[model samples]
Target: MKKTAQPGIEARKNLDFGLDANTPKYWHSNDPFKTRLHDALQSTFPEGERYFIACVRVFNDRIEDPKLQHEVKEFIHQEAQHGMAHTKYNQLLAQQGMPMKRLLAFHKDKTQKDQKRFSPEFNLALTAAFEHFTALLADAYFSNKETTAGMDPKMKALFAWHAIEEMEHRSVAFNVMKSIAKVGYFKRSCAMVYATWMVMYFMFSFADNMLEADGFSKWQRRKMFFKNLNWMYGYKGILSSFTPSLLRYFKPSFHPEEIPVIHNYPDWVKAYDESGNPHKACEALIAAAH
Candidate 1:
């Protein structure tokens, strides 16, 4: 397979997402299902991103390519900022009564154990798989209008910035696994399987917790989960557009750069470059969608 360097990973250091009490309870168009789902995922970002950075850092010194080495450092910087940004947002969720401490502590413990039990190469492979998942999510965010149609401006800006950066550095982990760790096709495929199951488990689990906390009984939560299924898997749903890309990960020759970046990528980047604000970048994206 022909390989290439990822586009530059720019660190937009110390970005403040401006989340607070004024942020609505159901921030995603006042839809409980959508808001809870998004909040659950955002809740995991702090710990999950730290785990991602740790996995990549394990192999940093072993990387021989100058370009990959530099990108790895920038990747760490970006991931750190992502963790910090999400930490602030999660605090807001806690203030709104989301049991942030217990849930995140649970996830933190799980990740720490994972580091001890798994080999560094496997953890890095898993990190690559999770990156692929997030890249798919970034595509979903920008490529599907319904996903962001009525999202809160501050929330939209936060996710848009993260998505653009996800696209920017999507290839870093996979390249490190393939080029630096020399992991084989079987292990790489296996890692995706493990990642898919883990993501589905925790994301839904957290979403379920949110719904339960909102006073839903088990039956109501089950009903809501099924109802929201269409939003995720419907013909034009967020996950619907990217099945092919998800499957492409299992191919022996798969590389993240092969998938087309969102069409609005350049416009968003230009907006941020010109204004030095992610909210402006998000506004540019919304304008382009019209």
Candidate 2:
């Protein structure tokens, strides 16, 4: 497969989301399910992104294209910045009694073992699969305003900003797999299955734990879990629109850039650059979808 065109990926090393104790327990529209769903993903990022970086970096020496090589470096920088920003944001959730460290330990231990047992090629394929998952999420989110309605501005901005970069560099790991690691259709496809299972298992598990901490009983939590699933896959649900794109990964010709994204990244960047306010950046992004 040929290398797809890459948009520039920059590390916005200093943007701040103003996370603090004043932030509410349910920052996503004041709903426990929405808030914890995002928080669950945030809880995984610091360690998971490090794993992504390591997986891609192992093949850096073999990347021959100058453009892709530069993208790889910027990709490292961007993912590192993402990890740091999420770490700080996750700390705010921890202070709210979310059991952040304990939840994080589960993913961390699993990652360590994967590193020990998996080949670098397999890890890179896994990273590519996860990156595709994130890109799918970013595309679904920034495209639809309903998904983010009434979310706290600070939290929304943090996620919108992260989503912007997720779309921007969505292809880096896949490029590494295709161009350098030479991962085939079978390995990448299998990795997507594993990645999908891990995402489903961990995201739901983390959200369930958060609800339990919120004093919901088993029966209530069980009901809430189905509600959350419908919210994701129901008609016009957050992820409902991405079913086709998700399946597109199994195609032999799939590439990240082939997926169209409606988020106005250029305007969002311009807004953030001029004002240095994440909320304004998010506003610009949302407005552009019309």
Candidate 3:
């Protein structure tokens, strides 16, 4: 696999989103199923990202390359910011009566258990697996115009900014794993399978719980399930779109940077720059709305 020049990672602060009562119950494409799916994923971030940071942190002293060490610091900063930002979003979900508290507790407990049961190398491999998942999803978000077309502008910006940054630092954890002598193809592949199963199981489970909490009728719930399933696995769905990239992980020589991203940072730098203050921008937008 030919490697392209990697984008630099920076940990920008003060990112904010316009989340409130006015924000739709189904924020993603105004579809209840999609919205719940995203809500479930957001609920995972607070705990999940911290795990990623910690997994990479375990190997920090072992990494001899100065450049990689710097990237590790930035990766920690970025993941911390991601956790904080998603915590706020998850709070909004709780405020709106979603089952965020219970779901969050479940995720936190799961992470804690994994930390105790898994070796540092396995944990880091899992982190790399998830990073690949996010990078692939980010690529899909940018390539698929319909993905964000019906979203609230502020919410769209929030997710888009995250996708761009995910792509930017996608290789950090993978590289860190590579630096460790014990990490190898077998462990990485097993981690990918385990990570994918766990993520999908939790995500759909939480989505189902959220939909139930929202008071959807039995028939409506049934209808929405198929809709979401079709949207995820049907022809031209996310499963089809991401499968190729996801499969690349099984290859002995696979690397995160090997997967091509559909969008580039230069196109999004103005609105979501590494140095810009998104919090102030969000505040100004809210103030103007009144």
Candidate 4:
């Protein structure tokens, strides 16, 4: 077998995206299925949080790619906020006594291992793939009248906000790869194919792991798992949602705007922020649940 050549990688400046812990969206438990998937997706969160931090760490280590650099900074901004947003929701969920520490630690180790052992191109390639997955989930939440209707408006708003942002920041990682990645076309192609498979596989492993510990009976949990599976499989019909986005990478003329935007949020999410917070009526429901 031929030795695979390592890909070129570069760094970009970190942006100072600050955190505000009291966002309106955090005021209550999101749907249990949605929340479970939240943990599953969030299990991978720190790696992404660190990817940008890593980029910022390495910024001075290599030549800059200007547009890619800005994208990195902005992506980091959104991710940093995402970490905060999810942390709040996850914490409230943790108070349900399903403590996420084990899941968090396990993934943290996996993230570190991947970072040290893999080529930077591989990591960025993986990041791009995961972002595509998130973009779909986010779109589903943002645009689905079914999910959005007749719910706690705050929670509905949370999903919508995340969806728009996912679309907004969709290309950050791959653009960075384009800026500095040096793997040949074959390796790059393999990265996408490999990444797509890896994401589905990871989702399976994550769902299985969470089911074991979420306090559900074997039968009920199995039903929930299938419910999740059905939603995932047809969320936007087949793998077409993912494949279309993935193929764009191969096109020389492909650009971010060419990707479809999923939703126009109701005017309230941005406007809801006097302090970017929800009405205090949420506290009673949350307290009652616990």
Task: Return the TM-score for each candidate structure.
Answer: 0.96, 0.95, 0.91, 0.69
Candidate 2 lDDT tens digits, 210-274:
88888989899888778677788888777677778888899999888887655477778899889
Model 1 spans with C-alpha error above 4 angstroms: 1-6
RMSD of 2: 1.7
Clashes of 2: 0
The candidate that wins on lDDT is 1
RMSD list, candidates in order: 1.6, 1.7, 4.3, 9.0
Cα lDDT computed for each candidate against the true fold: 0.85, 0.85, 0.79, 0.53
**Model 4, which residues run further than 4 Å from truth?**
1-34, 55-67, 150-152, 227-229, 235-255, 263-290
Q: Compared with the true structure, what per-residue lDDT tens digits does model 1 show for residues 90-195?
A: 8888888888888899889988998899899999999999999997877788765666988999999999888888888899999999988999999999999998
The number of residue pairs in model 1 that clash at the backbone is 0
Q: Write the per-residue lDDT of candidate 3 for residues 181-258, one digit (tens) a residue.
A: 369889999999999998898888898899899998778888888867767888767666788889999999888887
**Candidate that beats the other on TM-score, 3 or 4, i.e. the better one:** 3
Instruction: For each of the candidates, give the backbone clash count.
Output: 0, 0, 0, 2
Between prediction 1 and prediction 3, the one with superior TM-score is 1
The most accurate candidate by TM-score is 1
Expressed as tens digits, the lDDT of each residue in 1-290 for candidate 4 is 12222212222122121223333322224445545555466555545566645643343245376766666666777777666665665565456454467766766776678778877767666666567667666544444345434345555444445555666676666556555664455655666677667556655556556655666677876787676565456656424435566676566444444556543422323333333443222222222221
